[model samples]
Target chain A: MLIKSLAAEWLKMRKSYIWSILAALPAVSILIGTANYYANKSVLTNGWYSLWTQVSLFYGEFFLPVLIAICCAYLCRLEHFNKNWYQVMTAPVSRSAIFISKLAIAGIMMLIVQAFFLLLYFCAGKVLGLASPFPIETVGWMSRGLYASIAISAVQLALSIRIRSFAVPIGISICAAFIGLGMYVMKLGMFYPYSLLTIGIGALSQESLTIAENGLFLAMNSLFIVIVSAIAIRYLSKRDVVA
Target chain B: MNAIVSTHNLSKRYGDAYRVNEVNLEVHEGEVYGFLGPNGAGKSTTLKMLLGLVKPSSGKVVVFGKEFDKNRLSILRQTGSLIESPSYYGHLTGLENMRIMQRLHDVPDKNVCEALKIVRLENHKDKKAGLYSLGMKQRLGIAMALIAFPKLLILDEPTNGLDPAGIGEIRELIKSLPQRYGITVLLSSHLLSEIEQIATSVGIISDGKLLFQGSMEALQSKSQPRIAIKTVDNETAHVLLYRQGFHSVIEDDALIVKEMNDEQTAFANRMLVQAGIDVIRIEERRKSLERIFLELTGKEKSL
Candidate 1:
């Protein structure tokens, strides 16, 4: 039943314009980051790591959270469009399957976007004639970034599922992203969903996390995902959803 | 016949007021049950509760002899429904939409094509559902509901967006489903005439309450025929009939006798004529089904 539910969700994702979003955000961020790196080549001597700070700054702080929100909202937009919730809720499937399947799809989308952003980063470095070898720590950044993204997707998916308006959830994500910036400045990044993205991507600081810090980061993200998903599934099961 | 679906005191409340107040619906196997009501009569809420789309505030739903709360998925597996408006992905083609339902229900791929053909949407199957006309969208919704070959079909205003010809076609299709495939249907409509043409049994709701529930013949039987007698003097004729143990009332300048048969009409006319009263007119008027529906719905003032 979960497989079938996943397939149903995947079927709706077909022919949608979501790919354009996945491609545009990272591409535009690379453009701005490369320009900033070239303009600051006088004093910056950290090579690829320096470029990472510049590129991930806009992508992680603002664009990435907004991207997750848009993707989650778009995933639910079809169901909220014309009473499609009635059809899906009445289907012979568990509510957990439906909620989990959407979260999975959002995770997959974020994975693709993360990989694309890394590819663009590498290409930008190569194009700049940077002689330093690619930083191995960047791969760790990408994986952690994807994990944090899935956590954010889970929360956004819950909001999108409850609210019918497409723009409202996305707007809330924007506001939350700003608050996350404040939390990151206070060294409370691991406690908030949006700030986790900033810290995971090393958007402002490219330094590596200690072994204990890495463990806490992963644990915190998992905790948020589980709690948010549980609340969403419970609400879906108990509430009445009209067409 | 066994009841394919039944609700025991099902109710839904919003805040302090009830949207559906203790609606007990019984839909039997091999019969088309029409849920008749005026607008905002809680028809949709009651239907949603039956399908588990809406949670009942204080009651339970039983389908196929199993409680809905305990066996929702299993019960829903055998029931197909199109509630309120048609639901579809505007981006996908009609065929694609049907295929999704087919996969969810775990039916064969061929069932998709067959269901489309049943709704006469086979030719337009490749068109995006959003671009289809309102009637076509409605047909596609019905096709998707039928794709799984569910034993119990619940349709709320299935013919809502169709033209006259399209409405007639769907009406015929729904009427044939029971005999053709043994699918019992629970259909809802605000039009009494629509229910009259399609339903074998009926349940009428008003103000969130089930006003009446019985066979079509039973509802029709409520429309008793009365004898209206017009004489040279209606006042005297009314008194004379009252004295003869005939309960009558004067209305519209005629003496109205309630629930009179052919023999009673003949006897009353003969008695009036021999009493030196000129029997100008003796007409039998059967109350219309529409009037009875209005009265049950508490909208008789509009008539």
Candidate 2:
């Protein structure tokens, strides 16, 4: 059922500008990220780690959350346009199937954006002519960033589904990003859903993650995914598609 | 015939007022059940309840002999609906939108083109839905609902934006639905004559209540003939008609007397003249469906 819904979801996004936006945000992050890395390269030792230190922080903290939110908001924009929820709801699928299919599609879109970011980050490092051995830890940082992105995507999906206004979800995401940054500064980033990205990406950490920190990150992410996905699915199923 | 949709005491309340209050409705298989009501008269609410778009406040909705609460997906599998206004993807082209619906319904691609041809939108298939005129948009909506060729089709004022010829085509299409594809239709309309044209059974609702539900013959017999008289002296005619023990009410520029036949019309004319009141005209008129609709809804004064 979700596969069929995804097929349908892909058709809706064919001509939409969401593709450009998805590609553009990562480009912005890459541009800003490599620029800052090069400006401070004299004080840095490890080239790839130095590159990630700048790039992933900007992507994980700001661009990633808002991009996830916008992807969700645009994915649901069809439903908001011309009252398409009433049409989709009457299409013989269980309400849960409808909600989950949307989440799954949003997750796929999030992956696309994350992948684009990883590609751009690597390309920028190559362009900077960095000669240090490839920092395999960069893969862990990007994967964790993707994992934490799904958690944030769950909550953003819930918000976009409940609120018909598109701007509200994006606005809420902007505020939450700054708050997540605050939590990151306070050293309690591992506990908050918003700060999961900062902790996972090791943005504020002096060194790469320890085994203990990694376990905690994985545990917190799984718990958040289970609890938040359950809540979002329940809320969406119970909602009345009055439009 | 077995009922495809049966509602018992179905109601939806907002605040203290019932949007649909204790309405019991039955739509039998292979019949076009026309739900007739004026605006804000619970037509949309009742249809919404059946579609599960709006939850019923109380009562049961049984589709295909199973409760909607238990068999929602099953019920919806065989049913398609259009509520109030048509819904479409303005960004996608007409054909692309149809493809989306086809995928969502998990049906074959063949139905998409066939449905577009039925609505006569095959030529405009590549055009963006936002550019389609209101009538074209309405046809696209109908095409989407009919694309799956479901056994039951529920439409709320489906003829909204169409020319007279387009309406005629749609009426003919609806009439052929029962036998051509064995589709049972439950459509709501505020236009009495529209229902009179294609309905097999009619349900009249007003202020969230079902005022009448029966065959077309039953509705016609329920409303008897009346005399509509225009006179130079309406007040004098009323006084004279009252003296003769006849009931009459003064509408704008006309004196309407109920239950009047040819004999009563001649008698009223003779008596009005005998009482020195000039009778300008006395026309014997039959009760039209519109008149009966207004009478049933008690909105006679509402122009």
Candidate 3:
């Protein structure tokens, strides 16, 4: 079921002609980052955090989340726009499988967008001639960044599924992004939804995360994701589909 | 014979409005059952409940001897449906959509070609669904319903918006399913003519109630017979019938009476002739489903 669900979403993404943007975002973000790095070789000493903060904001904050929302929204747009939720909900497959399949797709798309961000961030660092900072835990940091982004995408998926209006979910995601900034500072980082992004990017900045603090954050955020997802999926499975 | 599908007092209420009010239905295996109703009469809502797409506010739907709520997946595996408008991803080819759904069903044999052929859409299977005409799209919807070789197929308004030829084609396709594939079909339509020609059993609904449910023969037996009379003075004949305490409607310049058996009609004919009324033609015609429906609903024509 998971594989088929993944395939279904993959088909939607590929057929919707999103591959161009999927391929373009990383390339374009990387080019911009590399050019910025060359223009400020003196600032290369400012370390990987500042350089990455500069690069990832373009890829991560603006391009990546929007791309994630578009893919997630588009995945649902197939059902919403064509009124195909009625078609899909009636299929022999269980409603849980259908909902989970969509969730999996959204998560996978988030994974892809995160990987692209990491790949471009790394490429930008190399082109800028910045000595690799904290080279030992690069994989760990990248994985944490990906994990946080995925959790955020889970929240986005739930929001997208519940609302019928396309722009509303997208608008909500943008607002969440801004809210994430404020949440990152309240020292209640784990409790705030957006703090997942900051914690993730902070971890990648070589900030030490005490296992207890990070674990609590992970647990709280994952719980938020699961709760929201359950509500959305339950609503979809139960409510009479108007379409 | 076991009923392939049965709904026991199945009702769905939307706040104050009851879309389906205690509808009791029984569709036996290998039979083509028709649900006939006008727009907003809840045909689609009832179907959605049967499919488990909409939760019933009350009552139960049993399919193949299993309760729908408990055995939803198991029951759904043996069933296929097209409710309301057919929906498919516009970007995907028809074949792709079927393949995706077939994969979800874990259906063996991958008889996508055979399914397409059943709807006569094999040649156009590779085209995007967006490109297909309405008739073609409806046919593809049927093809999807057949792809898994389900034991029962539920089609709602299968012929709506189709041309006469398209409607005829769908009728033939549905009729052939029982003999050719051994699949029981439950189809709903607002067109009484369509149901009259295709349905073996029919259930009529009005104002969210099941007005009647039985074999076509049973429905016909209950219907008021159509009385056709050809007279030289059509208006005078109509007035004379009214004056004689016989109510009749004007149809194609003829007076059409109802509820009169052969002997009563004969006596009326004798009286008309004796009254110097030139009756060129007098015959009892089969009551159309429409007239039966109107009469059953107690709807009267206004002056």
Candidate 4:
């Protein structure tokens, strides 16, 4: 049942123009990051690591959260508009399958966006004539960034599913991102959902995480994803759908 | 015949008021059951509850002899529905929308083409559903519901937004479903003529309450013909007829006698004349089905 549900979701996803969003956000972030790096190159001694901090700073803190919100909202936009929820709720599929399929699709789109961001980063480093060898830790940044993104996607998906307006969920995500930055400054980044992205990507700082710190990061994100997804599925199963 | 779907004391409330109150509905096999109501009469809400789209505030629904809550997916597999407005993705083509339904229904691909052809949308299958005209979009919704070839089909205002010709086509298609495909349909509409033309059984609802439920013949029987007598002295004629065992009431300057056949009409006129009432005219008036519907729904003044 889940496989069939996933197939249906894939069909809807493929026909939409969502790929353009996945490609555009990362490229724009790179442009802004490159400009800021050039302006401050005199003070920044580390070649590739300094660029990593600059690029990932904007990507993880603001653009990525907004991007995740957009993707999750788009997945649910079709159902919310024109009373399509009537059809989906009546379809011969389990509610769990429907919710999980949408989450899976959002996760897949995030993966694509992350990969493109890394590719743009590599190209930007080569273009800047960096003398130092490629920083291998940046790969860790990409992988951890993907993990945090999935948790954000789960929360955003729940918000999008409950609220009908397309812009409301995205607007809420922007506010959450700012709060996440404040939490990171207080050294409580490991607890908040939005702060996890900044810490995972080492956006504000490029120092490698200690082994215990890395374990805490993975465990916290997993907990958030599980809790948000559980609440979403329960709400869907119990509440009457508005069509 | 066995009932394909039945709801026991089904009710839905919003805040303090009831949207659908104690609506006990029974739809039999292989028959077109017309659910009749005026606007805001809770027809759509009732249908939504049956399809499990809206959870009822109280009561239970049984489909195919199984409880709906416990066997929702299994029951839904045998049921096809298009509730309220039609639902379709504006960006996807009509065929693609049907394909999504096909995958969820786990039916063969050929069924999608066949269902589209049934609704006469095969030619416009590639057009985006949002771009299609209102009538075309309605047809696409019906086609998607039919792709699964469900045994029980529920439609709320299916003929809405269709031109006369399109309405006729869909009406005939729905009317033929029982004999052609053994499909039992529960359709809701505000139009009395539509139900009269297509329904084998009728359920009328008004103000969140069901006023009547029975076969079409039973509903028509409520509109029996009557004899109207216009006499020079209607007041005396009414009393005389009543004394003579004729139940009559004076309305519109005439004595109206209900459920009177040809023989009774002649006898009543003759008796009135013999009593020196000086009958001026005798007329047979059959209450129209629309008037009965309006009267039962308490909207007689609107007529």
RMSD of each: 1.4, 3.2, 3.5, 1.5
Worst 10 residues of 4 chain B by lDDT: B258-267
For candidate 3, write residues A34-63 as lDDT tens digits: 667667767666666667655655555555
Model 3, position A188: C-alpha lDDT score: 62
lDDT of 1 by residue, B1-303 (tens): 899999999998999999999988899999999999999999999999988888899989999989999999999899899999899999999988987898788899888988999999999999999999999999999998898889999999999999999999999999999999899999999999999999999999998999999999999999998889999988888888888788988888888899777887888889889999999998988889998999889888765
Candidate 2 lDDT by residue in tens digits, B132-242 = 998898899999999889999999998998999999998998898899889999999999999999899999999999999988889988777668888888988888889
Q: Which of candidates 1 and 2 is the stronger one according to TM-score?
A: 1
Q: Candidate 3 - CAPRI tier?
A: medium
Maximum-lDDT candidate: 4
Error of 2 at B300 (Å): 2.3
Choose 2 or 4, whichever is better by lDDT.
Answer: 4
* TM-score sort, best first: 1, 4, 2, 3
* Cand. 1 Cα-lDDT: 0.92
TM-score of each: 0.97, 0.91, 0.89, 0.97
lDDT tens digits, residues B5-82, model 3?
Answer: 999999999899999999999999889999998778889889989988888999999999899999987888788888
Computed on C-alphas against the true complex, the DockQ of each candidate is 0.85, 0.71, 0.62, 0.86
lDDT, candidate 1, residue B169? 94
The residue pairs found clashing in candidate 3 are: A180-A194
DockQ rank order: 4, 1, 2, 3
Candidate 1 CAPRI classification by DockQ = high
In candidate 1 the C-alpha lDDT for residue A10 amounts to: 86
Error of 2 at A64 (Å): 0.9
